[model samples]
Target: MDGFSFFIYAFLSIFVIVSPLSGVVTFISLTSNMTLHEKNEIAKKAVILACIIAVFFAVLGNKLLGVFGINVDSLRIAGGILLFTIAFDMMHAKISAESITEEEINRSQEREDIWIFPIALPLLTGPGTISAVIVLMGTAPGFQEKIMILAAIVLTFAISLLMFLFSRRIHRFIGYNGMLVFTRLMGLFLAALAVDLVATGIKNIFPMLGKLV
Candidate 1:
């Protein structure tokens, strides 16, 4: 794809995987007992932390793969499978266990560093998000494409931070069922993207398969 098209794809892929609406839902639930100021603080901190984590992985993840002697295609296949499972859970309108469990969420309520723990680590930038960014970076052709991916990451989290800041208003506006509908639609798109990743990884690993196609 051309630069513009690739940038759009990168943006959508990162945004869909991040699913700011889903994060908004979790953020609302977590901060329901807090004051507006407190909630806003947590929201800002969480988004900044999540964005940093994603950018870190985007830049250095390939080096980590090299350390482990792992191929990018292998990671693509694995990340795709992981994302597909999360997508299935999202389609059902359930919070994916891959991100956070009910027990973790409950425990997070009593924790002092909830923003860093559940909010930033797993809830916002969980395994699925980490894997997706790394794989995206791996697929990028050069420095320019990688920069586009990084821009996508930054944009995704910027929007997410806004959603989190207005989370309460958004929750009340969207309602539970509306949020579910949106989650399902995003899930569908994510599943398709996951499949595409797996297929492309497979083709790359076996060039003869591409010839067959």
Candidate 2:
């Protein structure tokens, strides 16, 4: 793939995996009691960790898959299912443990350490994002293409990080209702993307699966 094609792929991959619209609420709710400095630090760490994980997967993901005897099509199918689940949750505006409950809020006056674990790992660089890296590597045409893909991933992560860091401002601009609508729309988009992934995986793995059905 060329630079443009790589960028396009990166953009979609980042959007689906990062799920920034969904993260907006989570960031705000999680950092409700945090000072600006603390929120900024958490956002910075989460993005940095997410970027590192994505890059690592882009480099060593396929090799690891080979060791496991897993194929691209299988990964796509599995990723589709996982993405769909997140999509469902996003549609309903479900907040994971990141959201602060009144009891939890009352229990602690200081902000808890939620930056690296859930927010950075499973939440940001979760199954969908990792699967995307593997898929991108599998489809890469050359070194140039791989580099472009990396750049794209970095750009996407940067955007997501900025969104999370500035989530308070974003919340004010978008409002609760607007954010909900945006989240639902992203969820629908993710669901459609998931279906496409499943279809592609099935078609590749079982060529006759399409014709048989």
Candidate 3:
């Protein structure tokens, strides 16, 4: 694909998997008692932190994999497993274990600033999305391609931040059940994508399965 097409592809892929809107209900619920300023501040902090974390993984992901003697195929399989698990949670409208835990949620209630805890750490920059970013970046064939991918990442996050800025309006418009339906649909698509990822990884690892491709 051309650079622009690749950028669009990457942007959409990350956005769908990340599903920033997926947490709209949770975000509105968490900050319902806070002032508008406070809500925006939290949104800003969370999005910025999440962006930083994602970029860090995107840039260093390949290096980390090499250092650990891991390969893209291995990453694909691992990421697929993680995404599948998260998909299950999404389908059930349950909090993902791979993201935040019950204990973390309980503990977060006592803290004043949750932007770093459940908000940024797992809400936005969770395991499923992080792994997806790394694997996606790893697929780039060149430095320029990687740069374009990173650009796409930045653009996706920017859109997410904007969505968060209007969280209240969005929540009200979509309502809880609407968001749930969207989340479940995304989860189903993510599950299928995860399976494809694993299948591709296995095919590459064991060329004997090439016929499956």
Tens digit of per-residue lDDT, candidate 1, span 1-213: 999899999999989998989877888889989999999999999999999999999999999999999999999999999999999999999999998888888888887788898999988898888988999898788889999999999999999999999999998999988999999999999999999989989999999998998
| Model 2's TM-score against the true structure | 0.86
**Tens digits of per-residue lDDT for model 3, 1-213:** 888888887787687777888877767767778899999999999989999999999999889999999998898998998899888998998767877766877777767789988888898888878888888888888888888878888887898898889999988898888899989987888888789888888898899888855
Q: Which numbered prediction scores highest in TM-score against the true structure?
A: 1
Could you tell me every candidate's TM-score relative to the true structure? 0.98, 0.86, 0.93
The candidate scoring highest on lDDT is 1
Separately for all candidates shown, the number of backbone clashes (residues 3 or more apart, or on different chains) is 0, 0, 0
lDDT of 3: 0.84
Ten contiguous residues with the weakest lDDT in model 1: 22-31
lDDT scores for all predictions? 0.92, 0.78, 0.84
Clashing pairs in 2: none
Off by over 4 Å in 3: none
Candidate 3 TM-score versus the reference: 0.93
**How many clashes (backbone atoms < 3 Å, residues ≥3 apart in a chain or on different chains) does model 1 have?**
0
| Residue-level lDDT for 2 in candidate 2 | 60
